[model samples]
Target: MKSWRDSVRNVVPYTPGEQPKEDGVIKLNTNENPYPPSPKVLEAMKEITNLRKYPDPAVSDLTEALSSYYRIDSSEVFVGVGSDDVLAIAFLTFFNSDVPVFFPDITYSFYDVWADLFQIPFERKPLNEKFEICAQDYYGENGGVIFPNPNAPTGALLELETVRDILDHNREVLVIVDEAYIDFGGESALSLIHDYDNLLVVQTYSKSRSLAGLRIGYAMGNRELIKAMSDVKYSFNSYTMNEPSIVMGTAAIKDEEYFQDTRNKIIKTREWFQEELRELGFSFADSKANFVFAAHESIPARELFEAAKKEKIYVRYFDKPRINNYLRISIGTDEEMQALVRFFKSMMNK
Candidate 1:
């Protein structure tokens, strides 16, 4: 019998959170915004009557808007289906070297899956005891460095100065910043792009903009790096970010007022939620993202996850040993957080 492709053999792909197709589950497992996208997004999609015509292969309008938003040249921007698509393109672009790609041991787990799928070599680096990125650890080896700011699952942020130090010290390596959740509250490495040509910042409209379903993400860097990623996309699927998504994406990015208000609301709710969790004997990482990483000293995370499921609430937990005891709970609205807290109070670490 013919087997599946070599890459497909016994491969455990990344498991996205349980998005129940059923009618009633409060899903907070994914770090999605609680708000719907701006009405402009709806208006834009409604205006698009032509489904037969192919989307602009270049995604020039969205790119230009994003470039103008970031004050970077349009040539330095490349839009993709999601940051995952662009990150995958990056794996193809800069990870062709024999050396292992390096990233924090506990970052977006999909980074490892992306490497496995692409058959790229990779090495994991432990984060500092404070759960912060240490630039020195990334130096002297590897083909590239990639990690989220206000890193995933943990949500611990690294300062802008530390970022500059890392890029300044590691001149040879391609430094990729996966800023999928950056809009929550963190310094963007995009600001450092003019100084370091190797820095590539990948971001999504999925988080702060409330457009995860739209599947639009873009990368910012110098023109040459953007060109390399673009080449990878063209070789695979030229018209990657389709018309509907591009339209929604443009509307999403352009709606700065909604973006700011929603992010601020999440931050406010997160602060109150953190205090409530702390009172319940839960330890959590200090976060600047839309989620908090936490576990109660008295409870096993797996138990809480299942219990929450039974209660029709969803939060994220990993089976990986170090993080198994912890849960990555997304910051929902004030009422949602209160409900989660109330449930936790009732459970009492059983």
Candidate 2:
């Protein structure tokens, strides 16, 4: 008789940033927004009294709000728990072919995890020496493609021309442009969607809109692609979003003034932090995201990571190849960033 253990499928899981429990810790590891959600979002949450009933299976209200904001048809929008949920469904829906999906070797770590969990074949194309994606590398045939616009950990932005080139080369397969950090500085590929029917542009409220707690993310593409992903999503879970998220997310999108104010603040802080890091002998690519990935000229990243923890200052340090010496420091409020600079100055002086 065959043992049940033989049927088990195992894969390495994705590790998220550490969420420290200590109070007064200057948390900056996870790249979370350093601001609160819009006041309108708070008001909307207070109005969500009907929790006894299940949420709309279609998530129509939030979907319509997103479509209106982006000036797209409702049929072109697909909402999910977060960008991760949207991406996972995309991988499962479009990457069933035998050909391998292509993404950067240094992209979002979840790409590989999702591919593995879904048993989809994938290949990691190496980024150039500058840690920027080479569009020519993706010119070859593949099942699908996905990469973040400003990228993660590296914060390198790929311009729309190059994005168009990639889309131009692989017109037969679906291409996903993950714009989680686009609001920080980089241009979004949403405009290219009308030109490239195979394109799916995914964005999140977690970063710019300061709505990570709401777990709201959506994708814009042609109606066909949106319909396919929605079908897959409904098959798995009809009510993936709760009533609170739908109401709060709709409010968050409508408050354009507050959204712009918070994101602009983070962008300004990131620029200031980058300059401070440079002065402290840290070197890195000019980041377009809300975080700066830097490496000290003399000290090791692990050393700085530990020293910051001792001071109750938190930042992300990856123990991976090529980027082992680098630290991804999330942009916080002006005061928090000033505190981080002080910690670095004190540590370097020691």
> Top lDDT: which candidate number?
2
Query: Can you tell me which runs of candidate 2 are displaced by over 4 Å?
Result: none
Question: Which consecutive 10 residues in model 1 have the weakest lDDT in total?
Answer: 1-10
For each candidate, how many residue pairs have backbone atoms clashing (under 3 Å)?
0, 0
**What is the C-alpha local distance difference test score of candidate 1?**
0.87
lDDT of 1 by residue, 225-298 (tens): 99988888899987877789877788778888888888899999988888998999999778899999998888
Candidate 1 residue spans exceeding 4 A from truth:
1-10
Positional deviation of residue 16's Cα in model 2 after best superposition, in angstroms: 0.9
Please list the C-alpha lDDT of all candidates, in the order they appear.
0.87, 0.92
Which residue pairs clash in candidate 2?
none
